[model samples]
Target: MKPMKTSYFPIIALSAVIVVIIMAGLLLSDAALVVDFASKKQAPSLSHPFGTDAYGRDVLLRTLSGLSKSLLLGIAASVVSGILALVMGIIAGTAPKWVDNAINFIIDAIMSIPHLVLLILISFCLGKGLFGVVMGIICTHWTSLARVIRGEVLQLKEQQYIKIAQKLGQSPWTIAKTHLLPHIFPQFIVGIVLLFPHAILHESAITFLGFGLPPESPTIGIMLAESMDYVLSKLWWLFLPGVCLVAVVIVFDRLGKQLKARFDYDNMRG
Candidate 1:
């Protein structure tokens, strides 16, 4: 018999850390809002591992709160984007030539724009809040995944089983439901997982640029934006939130890679 795989350990550990961060953020969210003028601008100490911001709020708690919000936003945006990609991909894969051409042209148009610029414009047009940021991410981030899914579907259309399904006189919708979706499910999962980091980073960047969440919001982007003024003042702790954001992004990136590898291995074995 083969020895037990040890590769799952990293995945488990990384997932646990992310869960804890999200949970801690939810729990500390209310507490993070409590400001103490007397404690403002304090450096890192035992009581405040990340120190106090100029507003006298606990940096660590606030960071956690922001991270949680970001994670949730990322989840929401990525899932929506993934679903959108799935729909467009199916249409492109099964539709008439003119329809597929239209879809490809639209995808190309969206992809040609600088991602961040498109995100900013969408968010701004949507009125620059939670809804705006989420819509922006969903619209901008779906293009790449949609293209991937479209390619997968196109390839699947050539497979013997799919050809047989077509010969069976199955409708495009039926074939998509019965054949395409199951085959592409793994890719969808992987795409969504990989999209999380991009969603989170874009949200933060949009917020930082004042096109996303409001300044009063407890988000990493807001935290970093607020820290900018104090950067020259040697308030090193102010940057802690930015560091945490980077760590969280890295964790998500690693988790996506691990999941992709696991899925690829499973596919190969199958």
Candidate 2:
């Protein structure tokens, strides 16, 4: 097939994302309320695309709802983590000597711990609910992005124009606002977009391990975990949510890579 026009790429990407979100949303309302023991464990068919789970709930609807839930949580976690990364990066890159050292030390301290263990500890401490998962993800996910931005800003700070601005008595804040931020914004956007998949995967992992959301929650992790029982029983529905989760993750990962390329310094200059 012929390639699409460059101008249409974002439109296509945005439409795919919207279609996924909209379908997930539309299926959410019906998924949570329907349960018929008579249809329990049905195979995939025309009337039930994903069939029914062992509980007789429509697997397709549940998968869609779980996907929507996970995506929303991932978005929230990524945004919070991204903002934390921005603040930490800015401080470490541009702050006074002592402040920079302090922030760097804190980052190192956190990085010393195993990430999943840290997430579990934090989530467990926060009581393992929606808030716990969000907070845990936000706290743990910022270090790498912060480090990237810190390096970018450190390089920017040494530029001849930055020195000129300092010599001309421009305040640090003023120089940062006018020069540093614009240079790093692209990097920042790329980091945030990339963070989404990690957030989603980590959220699911922690929830599956029982350190995030509760069993009562309608999340992708719960569906996958619960579906494990039927996997060996020749039940096609067991893998339905797992497949959907993989597809969603792949889509977001592709979107993130595309965003990164679009904002890439070399690509933009070209």
Index of the highest-TM-score prediction: 1
Give the runs in model 2 whose Cα sits over 4 Å from its true position.
1-12, 19-23, 265-270
C-alpha lDDT of all candidate models, in order? 0.90, 0.82
Supply every candidate's count of residue pairs whose N, Cα or C atoms clash at under 3 angstroms: 0, 0
TM-score of each: 0.94, 0.90
By summed lDDT, the worst window of 10 consecutive residues in model 1 runs over 1-10
lDDT of 2 at 1: 40
Candidate 1 per-residue C-alpha lDDT over 123-166 given as tens digits, one digit per residue, 9 for 90 to 100? 99999999999999999888888889999999999999999988
Candidate 2 Cα lDDT to native: 0.82
TM-score for candidate 2, residues paired by index: 0.90
- Quality of model 1 by C-alpha lDDT: 0.90
98-130 per-residue lDDT for model 2 (tens digits): 998998888898899999999999999999899
